[model samples]
Target: MELADRVESLTPSTTLAITSKAKALKEDGHDVIGLGAGEPDFNTPEYILDAAKNAMDQGLTKYTPSGGLPELKDAIIDKFKRDQSLVFNRNEIIVTIGAKHALFTLFQVLLNRGDEVIVPVPYWVSYPEQIKLAEGQPVYVKGSEDNNFKITPEQLEESITDQTKAIIINSPSNPTGVLYTKDELEALGEIAIKHNLWIVSDEIYEKLIYGNDNHQSIAEISEELKNHTIIINGVSKSHSMTGWRIGYAAGNETIIKAMTNLASHSTSNPTSISQHAAIAAYTNSEEEIERMKEAFEERLNKLYDWMMEIPNLSCVKPQGAFYLFPNVSKIVNQSPFDSVDEWVKQLLEEEKVAIVPGSGFGSEDNVRLSYATSLDQLEEAAKRIKKFVEKYSV
Candidate 1:
C-alpha cells in the first residue's frame, strides 16, 4: 500500500541513518565507532530515578492532564524563574513527549496551508520536515561560516515574506553548538516584533553550554518579545533524560491550549511515570548534572584540539552541545568523492567510523561528528579519520 504523499516526500534523518548503520556494523563484529548519535553518554541521575520509584509506589501511575501534571508544571515554572527570569502560568505550559514532539505539535497548531516558517541553515534536521508536515513552507535563510553558522538580523529580515508566520531560533544550536549572545538575540527579537512573527525558541541545550556565558532566552528579552516567543525545552539534554522522553513548551495560553487539545487526541499525555521523574529533575539542583557537563566540556576540548591538528579539515569550535560540524571541502576537492555524503560513506565503510553528512543538514562541504562518546573512542576515531584524510586529500 502507498503511504501518504507527505510521508513520501520527506527525507529520512541522516543522523539516525548513520547511527543505525554503525550499530549494524558493530553487531556484525566490526570495530565501528559511531559519532552520529546525539544523546549524552551519561545515565539518569539517581535522585530522579528514586522519584519515579516513589511515584509508582505511591500509585501516581494514572494518566495526567493532557497538558501535564500540575506538580510537574509547577516545577517547570520554578525552573524558568530560577534560570531565565521568565514567568509563566500553568495555562501557558504544556508537557510533551519530548522537545522534538513539543516543536512538532507547535508547528501543527500554528501553521496553515502555505504559511512560511523561517529556518536558518544548517538547521536541526526536523525543522523543515515538521513544517512541511504542518503544511507550512520552510523558508531557509543561509547561515554564514564567518558568523559561526548563525543568521544575522538583516538576513532574517530579508527571508520574510507576507506569508511568513514564524521564525525558529535554535541558539546553542544543534550540530554547530554555536550560541547567540543577548544583544544578537535582542536584534533578532526586534525583527520578529517588526514582522509580527512568532519566535519558536528551541533552548533544549540551555544547560549544556561550555563557555562562561549562560543561556539567555529570547523570551527574557522584553515583555513584547516574551508574548511573541514560544520556548521549547526539556530535561533530555540537561539531565540526561533522553530515554525518559519528557519535554515542554511555554507560550501564549491560547496557543498552548490549542496544542494541548491536539496532544489529548494524539498522545493523551507524556508518560505518567516520566512526568513524575521530570518533576524531580526540575525540583533539585544536583552536582551530577555539573559533573556531566564537565565531562562533555573536557571531551569537546580534546576533540577540538585533535580535529584542528588533522590536515584538510576545519570546524568551528563549539561553545555548547557535543557535536562538531567540520568543513571538509579541502578533502572533497582533492579526493575523488563528489560530496561530503560520498566522503562520509567511504569513511564508514573503510575506517568504520560513522558521521552524519552535512548534505542532510543542508550543507555539502562538511560532516557532523558527535563527541558524546568516550575520550578513547574519539581519539581512535580521530586517528582513523586522519589516516583516511591524509591518504586521500591533496
Candidate 2:
C-alpha cells in the first residue's frame, strides 16, 4: 500500500504512543502505574455535563456553521475579555475538533513548502510532525534543564532566518510544564514584531497552572502582538473534556477565516453538541476549574517532592500543568541499557511503571511523568519509580 509522501515524513505522537503501550500492559494483567497519560483524572464537572445533555435534549445535534455556533463564539470572546483582558470579534474565533485540529489548520493555511517554524526543544510531540505534514520545516531551539527548560529571547532572535515563518510558544508547556512570564513573553513579542513572525501561542493548559504563578498569553501583552498571534485553547485540559473533541483559536480575521475554510472542508464545524457545551464551559463560573486546579497542585507537589527524594533523579519544579519532566541523564548513562528508551522499557518491565522517555520529546537525557491520575496512583507510581532508580544507583 502506498501512503502519501507527507505521511512518510511524520512521526507518531510519542506521548499517545506511551499511553497506548501502558494500556496494553494493563490489559495483560500487569499492575502497571501509568504516568504517561496527560488528561486530568477528575470527571467532567456536573454543570458542564448537564449542559451537554441539555444541548442534546434541545436538538442541537445538527451541524453548526463551519466556523462555530455564534453563541459559542460569543462565549469565547467574553472568555478572552474576562480572563486574559483581551478582546476579539466573533469572526476572529473558530472552533475545531480540538486544539490539535486548530493547530493543523493554522499550519495548512499559513505555511508554504520549506517555510521554517522555530519550535523550542522538548516541545509537544505533535508540533514537529504537524509542521512536517504541512510541508514546513521545524527548526528546534534547544532549551536546557539549567534554564528550567525555557527558550530565551536571545535564542529566538538567533534562530530567525529568511525562511522563518513563525514560532510556537507553549506556556505552562506540555512536556516540561513551565510557564513563560509576562516579561519573557514581551521580549519574544518584540522579536516577533521586528522579524514579522507569527506567534502561535498554544495555551491549552492555561488554566491548569499551579502555585502563585499565572499563565500569561502573549496576546495579552498588547493589541499589536495580539493581532499577529493565534491563540489556541480548548476545553480538553481545563474542563477535562478531551473526549468531547472541541477546541478553538482566536486571532486576526484573515487567519481565522482561512482556518475556518480549511475546517469546513476537513471536519466542518466542531460537533454541535460539544460547541453548545463549550458555550457553558467558557461562560460559567470558574469554581469547578479552581477546585480542579487545587487538586492538580496538591498532586504535583507530592510528585515533585517524591522525585527530589530519589538521589540523582533531579527535576525542575514545574510551575504549571500536570507533568514533571525530570532530567534522568545520570541514570541513563549509569544504567545497563544503551538509551533512554531502553531504560524506560526496562523500568516498565521490572517495576510495572510507565513513563515517556525524554528522547521522544527531542531530549535524550530526560523523561516525562504525568501526575494527572488520582493521588493513590501517583503515590504508588512514585514509590515504584524510586525503587527502580535505587536498583540502578552505584
Candidate topping lDDT: 1
Per candidate, the number of residue pairs that clash is 0, 0
**CA-lDDT, candidates in order:** 0.93, 0.90
Winning candidate number (TM-score): 1
lDDT by residue (tens digit), candidate 2, 69-156: 9998899888888888898998899989999999999999999999999999889999999999999999999987888888999999
Q: After superposition, how far is residue 352 of candidate 2 from its true place, in Å?
A: 0.6
The ten-residue window of minimal lDDT in model 2 covers 9-18
Which regions of candidate 1 deviate over 4 angstroms? none
lDDT string for model 1 (286-352, tens) is 6989999999999999999998888878889999988999999988889988878988999999999
Model 1: lDDT of residue 22: 88
